[model samples]
Target: MFKNIKSTKTLVKKSLTIFLLAMTAVMFSSVAMSVQSLRGDSALDSKANKAGKHKIDTVEGGIERNFELQPPMIPHTIDKYRISLKGNGCMKCHSEKAYKKEKAPKVGDSHYVTRDGKTLKTISSRRYFCTQCHAPQTKDNPLVDNVYEGI
Candidate 1:
């Protein structure tokens, strides 16, 4: 009985060691793959060298909403927007007080409501970040055909 107990302990130790070694090997291989895959120029760093001087489309009206839930595309250039953790430059034009004066559309009332349905005077923290949903429009044509039509 004592011999059997010792053998069982040894088997458990061997299994645990093998499992730990396999986990270590998997972690190292994943880290190596991630490092190798990201070793290239990022897409954003590549400028429009072929598409002439990259200019923001500043046409007066905004583009059509792509689908039912699509956020409106930015109508004007936002290259100078200081959208950061410290301050939101977009609020200068889109905030309640400034929207009327600037003729820019006010932020939606939903922005002031919490997920639990409580309404607040200020934009909820979840919606405080504007560009999270809205994106600036690019002049480039779609890479693939968009067959979607909004209702």
Candidate 2:
């Protein structure tokens, strides 16, 4: 009975050792195969191997025919400007009352005109959003050569 118990213990220990060794071998083999596959043959390398000659050019904005040509782009940073139905940063300068004090050019009269050609005494609610027409002037190089001629 003693001999049988000892043999059983030995068998269990040997089985556990074999299971652990098999798992370790599987993990190492998978890692080695992935490393071999990734060596010097990635998709990024294939994309960078392309050969081409590219040309760059300067591009300008469209011609301005309107007298109030969008205020020559917002001269100052508008990050702090408030834009809401109740308040707008543009009104501080362009409004009838504020324009005189701020010395900023008032919004164009045409903006107050309705689609039916009726001009309102004040800025129309639909045209109150200043950024809708005015954009910040950025100093960045053009991405492509534009041959567009505006009317």
Clashing pairs in 1: none
Q: Could you tell me which 10 consecutive residues in candidate 1 have the lowest summed lDDT?
A: 35-44
Where does candidate 2 stray beyond 4 Å? 1-72, 149-151
Which ten contiguous residues of candidate 2 have the minimum total lDDT? 50-59
Candidate 2, 1-151: lDDT as tens digits? 9999999999999999999999999989876555523123446546443333332222244234345343445555577788897788778878888888987678878778888888888878777887887666445434334676544
lDDT of 1 at 51: 40
lDDT of 1 by residue, 46-93 (tens): 652344344567768677786766778888888798878888899899
TM-score to true structure, per model: 0.61, 0.48
For candidate 1, what is the TM-score? 0.61
Error of 1 at 30 (Å): 30
Q: Give the C-alpha miss distance for residue 140 in model 2, angstroms.
A: 1.0
